[model samples]
Target: MTEDDETALSRPQRRLLRRIYNGRTEPIVVEGLAFLTYKEASRYLLTLTEEAREAAYQEMKRQAG
Candidate 1:
């Protein structure tokens, strides 16, 4: 993202982006749309089931370990 784009995101959004990026090596996609920014992905993440979130967390740990 450009400097202006980075500055446009709120602190929470920036933090969310960091967390999401840390968890995966690939862009998040939902229903065929690619989520390259926190604004686009946060809603989808918020809507995930607990089981799905846990699965994603496990995958992140697996990748980290």
Candidate 2:
């Protein structure tokens, strides 16, 4: 698949992409949430409600800045 053609990817393919692109060998902890892998963190983000997702993004921004 092309780099821009994410819509065509299956869930497993997406997870694999996240694992490769995230560049983290260990689990990621963000806002006290612990993920088994970057792929898991990405999957968790997808499950959040819109408000919660925005809140998490804002928190990440705050920490980064």
Candidate 3:
């Protein structure tokens, strides 16, 4: 961020921005609310590898049997 942008941000805002820039993949609590970084949200995507899906399917079928 530019000097002007930094100057405009509160201390907590700057801290949160720094954490995001440094690739922190956890929720941050502000006031009483929790916020997830973009990196953390992306980690929750439902995509799975083919091998992983096949293994899970086999496990489920085995359990059903």
Number of the top lDDT candidate: 1
Question: What pairs collide in candidate 2?
Answer: none
lDDT of each: 0.53, 0.52, 0.39
Model 2 lDDT-worst window of ten: 1-10
Runs of candidate 2 with Cα error greater than 4 angstroms are 1-29, 34-40
What is residue 59's positional error in candidate 2, in angstroms?
Answer: 0.5
Q: Give the alpha carbon lDDT tens digit for every residue of 1-65 in model 1.
A: 45664554446645756676654657665455566545555445445576664454344334334
Taking all chains together, the TM-score of candidate 2 against the true structure is: 0.42
Q: Order the candidate numbers by TM-score, best to worst.
A: 2, 1, 3
C-alpha-based local distance difference test score of model 2: 0.52
Model 1: CA > 4 A from native: 23-27, 35-65
For TM-score, the strongest prediction is 2
Q: What TM-score does candidate 1 get on C-alpha atoms?
A: 0.39
Q: What TM-score would each prediction reach against the true structure?
A: 0.39, 0.42, 0.29
Q: Candidate 3 on 1-65: residue-level lDDT in tens?
A: 34553344345534544445355445554323343553332222113354643443344334323
How do all the candidates rank in terms of lDDT, highest first?
1, 2, 3
Which has the higher TM-score value, candidate number 1 or candidate number 2?
2
